[model samples]
Target chain A: MDTATTVLDLVGVFLNALLGGTVARRDRLDLFGFLVIGIASGLGGGLIRDVLLQHGPPAALTDPAYIPTALAGTGVAFLLDISPPDWSRAFKFLDAAALSVWASVGAQKTMGVGLGRLPAILLGTITAVGGGAIRDLLLQRVPAVLQDTRWYASVAVLVAAVEVLGIATGFPVAGTVAAITLGVLLRIVAEWRG
Target chain B: MDTATTVLDLVGVFLNALLGGTVARRDRLDLFGFLVIGIASGLGGGLIRDVLLQHGPPAALTDPAYIPTALAGTGVAFLLDISPPDWSRAFKFLDAAALSVWASVGAQKTMGVGLGRLPAILLGTITAVGGGAIRDLLLQRVPAVLQDTRWYASVAVLVAAVEVLGIATGFPVAGTVAAITLGVLLRIVAEWRG
Candidate 1:
């Protein structure tokens, strides 16, 4: 992965971990719960994608930066209560950004491994939504992505498709940028419409 | 990796898929739901273990037999009611047997890969209980093994430990047999007492 992608990937991990921590706080779970949920929310998607690729140990494990970044986000959430009044807008932005980065990175990674287009798109969508899905499952709820109203997963699928198209067309960098822009825009619009 | 282990592992997949199918049936899910649930229950554990090991594409995908076996189990449940009136005893037996075999095979596989005892034990427990945990999550329930009364996860932990010890002591075959026997006995006892 390039430096830009690496930075964005770590940012996604941090942001999602923070999001997971918010859920843990809402549930009144203890620190351990926050840690577990945070790690799952941050790293679960990439982990699933890498595993499916039959690649080496997941980047989440092999890369030193990922776990600590997730922990830092978790710590912030645990130590400070970013109440709903101050959270909604910022949360939405961060969530959307994370989704976009993950989708692009997932598709690119699959392509890097020489897999076909179908696997790339599938993995990209999975990489974007899987963490949240696992988090919801851990909390004993139907995944929000599976719900009719969330539209988060729809955005991921669209982002993945764009990334795949970009890579196929020999403009990987531009493709990632365009996909991310589209994802964030779509997610924000969906929330606004809701 | 051996023939006997391979046969038992596939058997475990089939049995767990049937268990997942039973859950889907109770939920009144359609055929697609059955296939989804069955595949998760049958293949989820091995997929998880393989992903964690970072060895190769999960055997569930690489080995064609795995998918078909899971489908067969789902097909049986979908085609026949196997109502609770006749399912309870058989269900318990099969569940216990599946658990025992997975626990043994998981630990052995980990050991074969030259990982330490802890990972082997952890993977073993995960392999034994992961499919059921995932199946429960998909049905929007807290995993049974995590509940106070299940004792299922506890059995898996014990089985894994035993396998680890056996492998360390160079008695892999005997260890697996002993672990399986112990797991089944303990599970049956737990159910009986309940």
Candidate 2:
């Protein structure tokens, strides 16, 4: 877990829980459905990553952070009843945040396991996007990446770039800053242009 | 990987694919979603069993039989434009078939791995129901288990009982016949009462 990505992942999952829960609520789902989405949206990515790595359950199951956070997020969404427009905005933020977090996490984990830079970058990309892909499949929807979403895949690349540069230069802070900056900027650019 | 459960686990996956895919089509899903449901329905129980056992992705990813059968089932449903009612009847049959499959698979896997019979039976029950539980969650519907609907869980227990009895008595064919008879009967009873 790259430090920045770790932080972002924590934040991203929390946000995902809220956003996914809100979406479930809008769909008029019952409590179990809401919690299911909240938990899934929050941890689905990591679970997919772990399963792929043959690691089993991953941090989502191993650590306690996600489940309770997601449960709380679901409760909040049910209580507050976020409107569609607001939910949409939250969704965009979540997408951007998750993209960057996944990218960095992917790269970091790949490198952590001693893979080469390129593979690390690629793994990072998959790690970041894996959860959403699983989520969409679960919901019976076309995955967002498969759809024409603006620069979705690019964020993952940018995540790798930061780490690749940092690894080359031996400046961990520089890599983190650069990667987060690139992801946030590109995401904002996509949104602003949209 | 339980020797006991392995008997029809492979066939169970294929049959459940047909069961799940038909249900998805009956629910009016498009092709891709239908395929997803088919795979989920077939693999869901086993996957759940594996995850709980910490042996994940289950046979869902590793087994050669599973993926193709699921795809074929979904393809057949789409090609035939299987009517909703006919699909529902298939669902009823599948419910019975899947339960038998899961019960044996679950008990064997759990017992093979050195777990107590109680846990094995429990795991088998979850294995039989877990996939449907997941599917319903994805569809934003209440899991039939959560409600007092039909003898869904009962079928799992019956299968487990047959398994337990066979293991106790050294009666292989008798055990299987007992399981099949119990599973099929419970399913028919559920349908008849409905």
Question: Over the stretch B1-194, how does candidate 1's per-residue lDDT look in tens digits?
Answer: 78877887888888888878888999999999999999999999888888788876789999989999999988998988775457677677877878888998888887777666766776787798788878888787866653436578778878999989998999988888899899999999998897
Look at candidate 2 and tell me the lDDT of residue B86: 57
Worst 10 residues of 1 chain B by lDDT: B142-151
Candidate 2 residue spans exceeding 4 A from truth: A2-7, A87-98, B1-41, B47-194
On residues A1-194, what C-alpha lDDT tens digit does candidate 2 reach at each position? 54555667887777777777776776666665565567667767666556555543466645556556667777888788775466566577666866787777767666766667887777777776665565565555677878647777767777776877786678866786778678877887888897
Which candidate has the highest lDDT of all? 1
TM-score of chain A of each: 0.95, 0.83
Instruction: For candidate 2, write residues B1-63 as lDDT tens digits.
Output: 455445456556666666566678667888778878877876788776787567645677886
**Can you write out model 1's per-residue Cα lDDT over A85-122, one digit (the tens) per residue?**
47678777877888998998999999999998888989
Model 1 segments beyond 4 Å from truth?
A28-36, A71-85, A88-91, A148-150, B1-47, B54-125, B128-132, B138-140, B144-194
